[model samples]
Target: MTITFVHLESVHHKLSKASHKADPFSDARESGLDIRYATISDAFPLDHDRDLHREKYWTTLLQIFPSYVDEFVRKLIRSDPQSLHFLVADTVYVWPTAIARKYNLINVSFFTSPAHVFSLLYHLDLLKERGHFLRKDDAVDIDYVPGVGSMRIRDLMASLSKRSDITGNTLFKAFEEVKKADFILHNTVEELESDTLSALNKYQPNYAVGPINLSEASSVAVSRSLHAEVDITKWLGSKPAGSVLYVSFGSVVQTSKEVIGEIAHGLRLSEVNFIWVARAHLTSSGDSNVLPDGFVEEVGDRGLIVPWCDQISVLSNPAVGVFFDALWVEFGGREHVVRRSDDLFPSDLRSADGQEVGGW
Candidate 1:
């Protein structure tokens, strides 16, 4: 069957470049799958400009991308009518499954983060009961997560508040949407997060088809011509194993000045080689001057602070030992919980072709 990959406009640009680089045209064409990219064209206003907090951002996104949403529905109807549509976007925003059953298209929502993170987000109510969620400047220990041992409240992202505020309520709503998905696709391998994967399977069909390092195996000849600027693979090839800490907060998370300093200190104290992608501009309500004075200079050759970098290539490298980033409540926590590959494919589940039989 044909699969049309739908993503938000911004994500579409990035994923398209990555996909083309990963296979050129021959790979996608040979799979008997026609890969088509489409995006809803709308930009939600900044959170601060709208006077909305973190939670309300979701509601604002729904409003800003109404046309994109309508286009999604129309595209499915026009495409194959019976073909499955694979949607890979920030599930917090582009949840097409709400309308999937109505259109007879199977909606597969891909979570680039860990399943445990989504699990915690899904059980926001339970977290609230155990006092796991905390308000601004409030501290609490996160000891209830399925696989993660324990994390301090301050160590958690500020967005994990249990209060009945706009952000909290909106997040809870998003979890409801997650529950209705046809299947959940996580960008983490089974080797890293088994317990969380098992917990997720009890609720919905799940797949751990990642590290999602398709870009790592792409031909350099095709990639060089496809995109301009830096070669992240070259940089990663130079680092030592388990020495460099890969730091990024995806595309949406914004870190505050205080938290940034704290992170720099944590990295320094940890005494690990690091690569930090720190955005100068603030997309959300937070200060960007969080890095300590002379932080970059102090770290010098040991640390590289760039505005943006290729995450897939960097993460796939053997030199990079640990991945570090601020744990936004939206991102679950700092723990890197993932499932092992062997755990994902049980003997009974394998087809004659040796592929997993059940769809996820």
Candidate 2:
């Protein structure tokens, strides 16, 4: 089967393509597969920066996304009426199922996040009916969500746990439509999330074939980073094995200045050799320096902070030890120390919900 990776073109990806920096699709070309590629306009101007005006950007995109998908699919079918087509989409988009049905294509909903998160989103109505949606009490246990077993309400992604905004509402709507998908694909491990996947499968044809980001070219390092990456090889290599802590909340996940300050203070107080991906758009307030005052001075040579780096390379590094998506909230300041890297896997590597997060 021919698989064409269709990218909803973004300004950052456009820049990356022009410069030939961090080609996310290079490995695909090198794989010698029947795979093809295409880019559809996200209906945003070339100069538009989504990070600068995130709310407006997403709100506008969500409003017009269905129309864009409809146009793209319509054109795709017109281009090749003879060839059979299967439409696979990220679960975040609301129009995939309808678009697929319109074009007589098999629709597949792919959930890239953890299956546990998917379970919560899939059962949004259950959460609402049970007074769990936007509940004030974070301490309440949420065991009723199918396959999720027992997890606290607060453990959910802030978007799921907290009050709903336009973006959140749109995301919830997308998940609601995902139920109509012909098939559901999760980028997760079946062994790890077997229960969750099994529960989801009862509703639809669900499959757990993942760590998909790794691709067939596992040895070849590739990054789809929109930001310029800092080469931390020399600095990271200097650190002893299992001594450095790697901290990043990912490209799009934003936190407040207060959370940033707390994490910074905790890092400084911990004094562990570390590399922190302090992306330029890490905060919504647009504060360039999210680090606390004297944070750099206090940490000095012990910490190497960067805008971004090739995450796969960093994780593969033997010198690197702990990886923290969340901050030092789990590990108290100065008191708790990460001694052995082995001690941090499977057990310590848990979501806020206390579920063991499977790694790539």
* Highest TM-score against the true fold, candidate: 2
* lDDT tens digits, residue span 1-360, model 1: 554544545444444564555334445555454655445644643224332154454565666565567666776678665555554445665446656655565677778777767776766666667755563333556777665557665554334644455555556666778788878889888888888888778888888988765654332222222123345666666666645767777555654454455566666655556788775443355455656788878777778877666666677778775565545323333221121212222233344466533221
Q: What does candidate 2 score in Cα RMSD to the true structure? A: 5.6
Error in Å for residue 209 of model 1: 2.7
Q: Model 2 TM-score?
A: 0.86
Which one wins on lDDT? 2
lDDT of 2 by residue, 245-308 (tens): 7898787777667767666766765657888899877887888988888788888888999887
Worst 10 residues of 2 by lDDT: 330-339
- For each candidate, give its TM-score against the true structure: 0.67, 0.86
RMSD of 1: 10.6
